[model samples]
Target: MTPRRGGAAGGRASRVRRAVILGVSVVLAAGALTASPASAYLPGPVDDPLRTAGVALAADAAADTGIAFGACPKDSGLAAPVQCGKVKVPVDYADPGGRRIDLLVSRLRATGPASGRQGALVFNPGGPGAPGLWFPAVGLKSAGPVTRKVWGTAARTYDLIGFDARGVGHSAPISCVRPENYIHAPSPDPRTANAAAQTRERAKARGIADGCGRRSASMLGHMTSADMARDLDVIRAALHETRLNYYGVSYGTYLGAVYATLFPRHVRRMVLDSVVNPDPQGVWYGANLSQDVAFEGRWADWRAWAARYDSVYGLGSTASRVQASFDLAMRKLAKKPAGGTVGPGELHAAAENAAYYDQRWVTFAHQLSRYLHGDDKPLVAAEAPDRSGAKAAENGDAVYLAVQCTDAAWPRDWGTWDRDNSRLALRHPFETWPNAWMNLPCATWPARAGEPVDVGAWSAELPPVLLTQSERDAATPYEGALELHRRLQGSRLVTEVGRGSHGLVSIWNACLVSRVDRYLTSGDVGDADARCAGHPVPVPSGTLGAKDANTGRYY
Candidate 1:
């Protein structure tokens, strides 16, 4: 379902969260392998050592003459006149001659003259599972003014390429549990729920893991980031591009980093927004823990914003009062769900949107105030339970687990997860438990774990890459950008000081868009890192309506 403004999937916030969960698992799978030289493909650790082999296979794969453009699928939801097609790629790179699958692709050809063309600018919208078939269209119709200007120039200079990475969207998608069987309600609140409730959550996680094993055993082992990176190379060859020019957001940053590590020489120009921490020790598990802390801070930011507009929301005149109001609502919802749908779990999920973007704060406050005042219609409509796209949602979740579970080894003992998350929940009450439960299936993932690519090993061989980040980004914290900057020796870092938005570049903030546009258009990596002051915090219009809402679009 297309998300409404100020509602669920507020632009890319909701969708980006789904991708964020899965993308968090991507970096955790790398083993402690030494970096490879630019000239050689180094094999990862023995747990899943096929990375080098996969790169070799991708290199040897036959080049496609070209993709034949045709009408996109009627249900694609892309407004631009984009042509959709598919290319066959081996399901397992190590066994290139074995089973093959279709990789769905979309493209909006450059409008400029042939001499001005700079080749394909491929995009991945961050989910290890999120589909990109609609990304090019998003650039055309949804970007902010500054971004629109940049995108307009890009449309004339590059063939904007978008694709559903394998096992996503229309590209041989995989599902673990049936739609009816899938569990959508949030797990019991770890902060207040009893041990029995938590145990039940554990069992639920196991059931999901078992279901995935039973249904998609063959694909589970092959769904690692390294494998996806191989698929990217295949995409590059099919496009007939000598070097890859890429843009990746959220988890896509990790994917792009992996691609660069694997094929440094083939990279032309790259942009990584909302950078992921490539530290092997922090991969999936530690990363989520860090995310919990970061989210808590963003939640505070939301509370302060809501408090400032207390005259409109009537929730509170101070941050602490705002928290109290929100907590009281949660308590009441636990007893009786608003509209018989938004229980404690759904309410928490709805409220979490505030952590991703400031634009949603007003909508969130409006919905919360209405719920407290006995009006549940808007809240219910905005955060209703998933029904129409239950199967597709399940597919994304399935791939999320598939890649993360096998990418790196998770703690096998439930005690470790309980101990770590329980201690963390005490300090960061906002997302610790819910985030832990969302990823609990990894403790017993069915596939064999693989080693992560040593992301820093070949940084020196890479072309000058650009990194953009917000100082207060909750999804991917600012420290990750610094870590990546240090790792990629020549990469330039652009910081949006005091901003909390998850995704940047063309969503808002003209300063960031200008830097990104200059890099894309002229290959200019400034002599030093740059910082831009964040846009002012949003103020409510005092009237709650669709007009005040920002559509889910950026990521």
Candidate 2:
């Protein structure tokens, strides 16, 4: 799904690319997991695939999309969802009267003081490609308490909107290759040159992207931040709101920015989590560097923890020394691909748990230790998506690339990538080439490049915006947040210093909650340097509580 970039002004963390969330749903055909033709335009509905409640479509332009005010099942939990009906938007907004596609919209009425209702605080988990539909229903652990209040306990207070983008989720799938080709195939070998691995990866990417272009013609082109902004308008019309109040994380930040830029008056309040810097090359470069650096820092944390158990695990004391050991394993794998087929590329892909999700820290540490000592069994098992979806998530990786590539122009010449990557791998070889290979589809994505939005960070006319970012973060990187704050003359940045993660909202930070709640409720993010909790002492292995296991009492 690599889209030939039209060339966005912002790079990885800038443009409305997908947020750094967990897997795309496997709800397509058997074992075919996917996200968007490009991305679940606004990913609120991808994860929350609760069987939709068959409700009548909005009668007119300003009909109600809210269901909590209507009726819902009494029970809560797995069965407890506001449930929604489909509202169709133009497949291509350019030709509104032509073809149509469904945007799965849902809202859990406000649970706060009804007398003091704050309109709708729409939730977008930033995927331009992520399916955020489950934000309200299942709460994928990142929607934060602000969202919980909306769909809290049940549909007591707020109205949440979680829709799969035009080509994502139950709306309509875009898939090129089946998961078997990627998943069932051998894991990567890390030691050798990454370029050869990238070639195979490109083949898999094209299978998905070209398949999407072939399957959905016009829909493929409509998969951009610009058009999705139009979809927001349609969402507004259906919601019957004069303005849209939004909460976006990761790429969701960009989505909110786009919506605000396109329809400033339509925004009542917007909270962009994990702020993206609008500088195209610099941001992606920063994002790449940031991931390498942050992961390295976290790698140290993993090493120190391993040190505490030095007697249990043979890895050395310092993070640097432990990394040396892991590097040795990668070299060995490069020379002799494991599992009879898996290579360095697949091995790194399998080990990507370190890139996101703190839950995997212990497992990865233990697995890496064993793999270094010649036990490849648990490593393969460690790489599976949590729950296999109804079917394979279709075209997710493909759609991810398609939208990204088409959304902006990436360097085409393999030479450029060769040189750039050689440099990146030199400094941050841990996840460097593997991460580069993950995004290789961008090199030859099928779609025509679209234009990147040159967005302003601040504006006098806009309502107060809250920008939350985790300092020392991977992926989106916190430095970009400062740039966004600097650019957005009126924007205030609340930092989660040293958290070492992306999309700093959720995961429990009192400072972030205070800043965001103030802004959302009272329409203000104070003009001070607001700081959230920095990184805490690294949690030890076997100390992972219920939350890490996804068995929280709340869940």
List ranges where model 2 is wrong by over 4 Å.
Answer: 1-78, 138-157, 179-182, 190-195, 198-208, 280-313, 328-347, 370-380, 384-392, 535-538, 541-555
Q: Global lDDT of each model?
A: 0.77, 0.56
Candidate 1 local lDDT, 172-280, one digit each (tens): 8888899787755532343453578787888989999999888887677888887888788778877777678999999899889888877776788999999998777
Which whole-number lDDT from 0 to 100 does residue 352 have in model 2? 58
Clashes of 2: 74
Q: Write the per-residue lDDT of candidate 2 for residues 1-555, one digit (tens) a residue.
A: 223323332353222112211122232222212321112122222112211000011112224332223332232122343555566665543223334667776555565567667666677776556776555563433445544533342233346566666666656655655444445434556424555766676676556556666665556666777566667666666666666778788777776776666555456778888876655554343455556655655555555656765555566776667667776767777687666555555556544555564545556666667777778776656543333542335455545655666667777777886787678777666656666666666666666776666565225546777788877556676667887676566778877766655655545454566666667667767757688666443343342211232212210
**Candidate 1 global TM-score:** 0.88
Collision count for each candidate, in order: 10, 74
Top TM-score hit? 1
lDDT of 1 at 156: 77
What is the RMSD, in Å, between candidate 1 and the native fold over all Cα?
A: 10.0
Provide the lDDT at 427 for model 2: 64
**Candidate 1 — which residues are off by over 4 angstroms?**
1-62, 139-147, 183-193, 545-555
